[model samples]
Target chain A: MEKTYKVEGMTCGGCVQSVEKAINAVAPAATVKVDLENNHVTVTGIEDDNLVAQAVENAGFDYEGPVF
Target chain B: MEKTYKVEGMTCGGCVQSVEKAINAVAPAATVKVDLENNHVTVTGIEDDNLVAQAVENAGFDYEGPVF
Candidate 1:
């Protein structure tokens, strides 16, 4: 399953890296892509919304979705 | 002045902190609030959309707005 989340509070490249690292840590095989200009996060593999949400929350940013 | 940005790529609380830090570093006086469940970021004391965008981008996440 692929999921895309709308996120908030990011402010730079480091924030992107942090979000990626945090997600990868929890969802090892999850493929994550971010479009800072547009504020979108697309993830592939594993459909646990809670896990995905926790990953973003744990990383310190607000996230909303499964927007699909 | 206040601004809200939709962000992407966060997966944990740490990501939130990182994003906040990144924004503060650049804007200093800017106040930021993130609502993960809603995917919203509220920022105050700044009116520069570019700077806000840059802050989020630098923090390593994707962002969109000034959404009012």
Candidate 2:
């Protein structure tokens, strides 16, 4: 499964890498990609929304949950 | 003067950019650089601590004031 989230406060490549690392830690098999220009992060191979959210927060960014 | 802040929630380049922009908006002359590996942001040319904090929060990240 795949999901997209609108993360606020991402402004550079470092944020892109941070979000990916954080999510990957929570969902090891998940492939994470961040569209910094859009402030959205897409994760594949993960279905647990709560876990993803937690990881996002833990990583120091605001995760507004999957974008509809 | 220069100040180093320990900001929480920065995870990638986007974060670095966001923080920089946020701070710059408040202190246009401020030179902001974020070290993702250390989760720290160094700002030069600005001296208002409260303003910096507000900018960080407004940027969606926790700004724990200049690192002692």
Candidate 3:
């Protein structure tokens, strides 16, 4: 399953990488895409919202819940 | 006055610049310094938290309130 979440704390390309790494660490099989322009993170293969959210927070970004 | 806000969404130097520019746009005279290492923004010469926070949101980042 693929899910997109509204996240904060990313500013540039580096931040984009961080967000991807952070999410991938938790969901190794998931493909994480960081949209810096919209502050959105799309994770494919993750089913648990808490898991992804935790990873995002651990990476220092605030997870403002999922993007509907 | 100098105020440090706990900002999120910055991952690299480019993010640092974006954050600075976002804040500076709101307060033209403010010296906005972005600390990517700590995800903090030190803005000098601004007094209204609302203004700074608004600028951040307008710049496409999430404003998670002030880091007091």
The numbered model that scores best in DockQ is: 2
DockQ of each: 0.13, 0.17, 0.13
Off by over 4 Å in 3: B1-68
Q: Tell me how much of the true interface, by contacts, candidate 3 captures.
A: 0.27
- Candidate 2 per-residue lDDT, tens place, B1-68, comes to 88899999877666777677767776778898889889899989987788888777655577787897
> Using DockQ as the measure, what is the rank order of every candidate, best first?
2, 3, 1
List TM-scores for all candidates, in order.
0.51, 0.53, 0.52
Candidate 2 Cα deviation (angstroms), residue A53: 0.4
Q: lDDT, candidate 1, residue A68?
A: 58
Q: Give me the displacement of residue B2 in model 1, in angstroms.
A: 33
Q: Following a full C-alpha superposition, what root-mean-square deviation does model 1 have from the true structure? A: 11.7
Candidate 1 error regions (>4 Å): B1-16, B19-68
- For model 1, residues B1-68, the per-residue Cα lDDT tens digits are 77788887656565667777667777789898877766677889888878877767655577776565
lDDT of each: 0.74, 0.78, 0.74
What is candidate 2's DockQ? 0.17
Interface RMSD of each: 8.2, 7.6, 9.2
Cα shift from native, residue A63, model 1 (Å):
1.2
